[model samples]
Target: MPDPIPATATPTLLYRCMTKGVKDAPESFEYGASWVTARRGMLSVHQDRLECGDWTIPYSAISQAVLFKTSQMLIPCYILKVRTATDSYQFGLSGNKFWSTDLPFPVTREKGRLRYSAFSIIARVILIAALIWYFYQAWA
Candidate 1:
C-alpha cells in the first residue's frame, strides 16, 4: 500500500504530471508546518532558506507542464514546470510519473534557457557598465 499523503501535499500530488485541467479547483489544505496554507491549489516555496510566497496555481489555468532534470548531485531528480497564461512556475515534486502524462510532443520547449525579467536585465546592464568603468580606471 502507498504511504498516506499528508494534508499539506501540493496540488499536483494527486496527478504527478497532469496536463488535463479539472472541472473545478481542488480543495484547500493547511498544516502545522511553518508555512500557512491560505487557499486551495497552492504551494509554499522557499528560496535561500526563506519562504518567498505561496504557489496558488488554479487547476483550470495551467496551460502546460514539463518534467525536467535538476542539478542535484546526490541523485537524479526532476521538477515540474507549470505554465499559465501570465506566468511560469516550477515545483519540486516527489514522484517520477511526469513522463506518463500526455504532454506535448516537444514538451513546451521552455527549459534550458535563461529567462530574464526587468530586474535581471537591469542587473546585467549595471554589471557590464561597472566592468567597463573598472577597466577604464585601471588603464588610465
Candidate 2:
C-alpha cells in the first residue's frame, strides 16, 4: 500500500460552525438523540469525507444536503442539513458558506422563503405605529 495522507493537510473546504443536532443517530452520538445546545466546531469537507471533530462521514453515505433559512431572534439564520442513509446532521452555518460549491453533494434550498410568525407581524405593526406616533408628537 501507499503512504496515508497526513492529518496536517488542509481540507478542500472548511467552515467554522456549530453542530445543532443529529437525527437517527444513537443517543451517545453527541449529547443525546437530539439536543437544543449547539457544539462549536470546525466542519471540513474532504475529497471523500466530511469531518467535524470526531465525526467522520464518507461522501458516499450522504444522501442529500439542504440549505435553508429560519427566523431566530427575529433574524434570519442559515442552516445546513446533511442526510445520510441512517442519520441526519444539522449545522448552523454562515450565509456566505451556504453557497459553497466544493461539496460532493448538491445543497438545495428550502422550498419556500422563510415564513414570518404571526407574532413577528404583530411586533412589526407595533413598531411602525410607535414610530408614527413619535413622529406626530415631534411635528406637533
**For each candidate, what TM-score against the reference?**
0.34, 0.52
Among the numbered candidates, top lDDT falls to 2
Q: Which ten residues in a row have the lowest lDDT in candidate 2?
A: 25-34
Candidate 2: count the clashes.
Answer: 0
**TM-score of candidate 1 versus the correct structure, residues matched by position:** 0.34
lDDT of 2 by residue, 1-140 (tens): 22223434655543333444444433212222133444566666566777777778787888877766654556565666778877877765554433454546666776334444555567678899999999999999
Output the TM-score of candidate 2.
0.52
Report clashes for each candidate as comma-separated counts.
0, 0
Candidate 2, which segments miss by more than 4 Å at Cα?
Answer: 1-35, 74-76, 97-102, 111-140
